[model samples]
Target: MANIDPIDARILARLQRRCDEPLEELGQHVGLSRNAVWRRVKALEERGVLVGRVAVVDPDAVGLGLMVFIQVRAGHHSADWLEKFRRAVRAMPEILGVYRMTGDLDYLLRARVADMADYDRLYQRLIARVDMGDVSASFVMEELKEGSALPL
Candidate 1:
């Protein structure tokens, strides 16, 4: 990790909440001049502490109301199989996150879709692209909290 002082932490916290906040306002909150905050932000980006900024959109509003966690068991563990799986997931925009996991599950996929039918289509497409031993999905009932902020 890069050297992050208290001010940098505060800046990161603020940015996590609102990436588009004016530099002057952010500086006021962090007790730094605008230029100082800018430099710090630039440095943080250079150090790769700060990645890309993006807008968080509402899934329901966008007609993607269902969030599903799909568990996958690999049919066979091989470089070719892994490469195919990676390419399949990366090409699917509905698949928001794919994690290579330990324990019983080989991989876990987080996806959003309009409904069960949409999910079925995604499943079909995925299975067509790659082979799997077993697949199961669980839909989210209520989201108590979901965020991208990291504790600084």
Candidate 2:
């Protein structure tokens, strides 16, 4: 990553909160000219700091009422096993997020389903495909807060 000074951080903070803000408005917020603000945004993108803009959707409204987190312990820790597991998880639309972790678990996965029955089906499918030694999962009781916006 390139050195992100205070100005760049401020620009990114404003952009995250209001991506559709015009160049003039964004520049004003960060004390830069419209052209300068535009250049900063472009540079941020080129440096991979600003990945992409996305629409945050409501999972419950979209027929995904159940939020589940699965901690998986694989039977083997080989490159082939890891690749296969990743590809399998990526192909599943219900699997919202996946992460490799440092713990007893090899992978941590976030999935959204309709209900308990739906999650059960997903669990069976996941284990059958990946040969995980152990699978532990928990349903989210409540979501206090979740957002992509940075604290900056």
- lDDT over C-alpha atoms for residue 108 of model 1: 96
Looking at model 1, the pairs that clash are none
What is candidate 2's CA lDDT for residue 126?
Answer: 79
Candidate 2: minimum summed lDDT over ten consecutive residues — where?
A: 53-62
What is the C-alpha lDDT profile of model 2 across 103-146, one tens digit per residue? 77888999999999999999888777887878899999899987
**lDDT of candidate 1 at residue 46, scale 0 to 100:** 98
Candidate 1 error regions (>4 Å): none
Per-residue CA lDDT of model 1 for 1-152, tens digit only, reads: 25889999999999999999999999999999999999999999999999889999999999999999999999899999999999999999999999999999999999999999999999999999999999999999899999999988
Candidate 2 backbone collisions, by pair: none
Assess the local accuracy of residue 127 in candidate 2 as a C-alpha lDDT between 0 and 100: 78
